[model samples]
Target: MGDDAPAALVEIVRRWADDPSLLVQRAAVAAICEPRLLKAEGAAAVAVDLCGRCTLHLVGLPLAERAGSDARTLRQALGYAWSVAVAADPGPGLGAFRDLDTSDPDVGWIVKENLRKKRLARLL
Candidate 1:
């Protein structure tokens, strides 16, 4: 889906990011985090946007709602996925990451995790 039509892939990823299922949300991040796919024109921006959306969803959930294995998996995927998108296009990618509400613990953790990556750490 990302090869011939990255925009369509982004749209689908957006929907998946908003899905109620945490695994589906994880899939959204995983799908867009592919380095090759992110190299596509404009794909990095969409990837960052979807990451932000998924992060927001996770942060908004109640504590109990976020404790499941699926949520943990999503969080783990997001830990490194942001760096991939930012590395692909730092301009919009970093801008989007900065736009996130990091005061939320989950969002803060995700930000910190991504910042730990050498790719994104070099930007800071």
Candidate 2:
């Protein structure tokens, strides 16, 4: 069971690394599984991690199955949403996100600008 989860996750990540479309990225979310023997043993369930820090739990739907679904479309939409969130969120490790309006689809485009303005590489 434990082995299955890592294998599946690796497969998905490999697929994503090739082309790197939002569809494959979202579908590659990791799932953890455990054994359960009903009442006495209790029930074990599988969970997928969307982002390591965020922990967006994906409902069942495996990567293979999602390939046929509207996954690509959903993934694009989610990527856009993530960018928007990243832009608006004013938290640590996200100092690169401030000063952006959600209207722009390329919200992450500002990262380079931030780096340039701060003269980070120039310091080196």
Candidate 3:
């Protein structure tokens, strides 16, 4: 499962990929799992793609609250998603956050936190 699990799990995430209503939960699950899959053969692309999509979903939201999880999960999931994206390649897909100044404080805080994690990832 470790070798092929990310792709399999990504197929599950793709099922809800187009539904804005379900994006948060789907992304939360992906965020929780994808990072571990990053080193898996052929898993990086799928995990990065999922994280990119999830990051876009978070950016497009007016507030992280719009992701609809109880508050804490929403914050943590977005952070994890961002970390996966940055750790993947730090490209525009996720690195784009470096250029924005969102009006929402929650969004701002989470982005900053994710960037911090990204830096930590690089350090380790």
Candidate 4:
């Protein structure tokens, strides 16, 4: 019973990682599983790619936040995931996330923060 929830949650994140129809569900589960899944086999790349591919303008962010996760956790997880994806393959990996719009205030803020990190890295 105790192990079942975590396993089930991970399974959900894996199963729906790239399912556009289920982006909200996938994001929710992924946000919750971000810490563990990032260390799981190939999970970080998959989640990062899915995050870029899915249209997460409305439901994804709110649902993820409401899923008992904090902003810092999500940001760290996403940044790590994106960094890993880019390191693995720059074109497809980085290109996937390039078109993300900075419209939603929260998403915009995150995108700006990520851009700032990248800019700072260039100077270093």
Which stretches of model 1 miss by more than 4 angstroms?
none
Q: Which TM-score value belongs to model 2?
A: 0.28
lDDT against the true structure, per candidate, is 0.87, 0.32, 0.56, 0.49
How many steric overlaps are in each model, in order?
0, 0, 0, 0
Per-residue accuracy of model 3 over 5-117 as CA lDDT, tens digit each:
65576566655544665445555345434556666654555555554455455556765466466445545676666566556545543545554455666567667777677
Q: Across residues 14-114, which tens digit of lDDT does each residue of candidate 1 receive? A: 88988999899999999999999998878888788878888878877889988878888988899989999888889888888888778877778888999
Which residue pairs collide in model 4, if any? none
Check candidate 2 and list the clashing pairs. none
* Most lDDT-accurate candidate: 1
Determine which window of 10 residues in candidate 1 has minimal summed lDDT: 98-107
Ranking by TM-score: 1, 3, 4, 2
Q: Provide TM-scores for the models.
A: 0.90, 0.28, 0.59, 0.45
Candidate 3 TM-score over all chains jointly: 0.59
Per residue, candidate 2 scores C-alpha lDDT tens digits across 1-124 of 3343545544444454233344444443322112121111111111111222111221224647445545545434333333332322223214323333434333233333334433223322
lDDT of 4 at 76: 44
Give candidate 2 misplaced runs (Cα > 4 Å): 1-60, 92-124
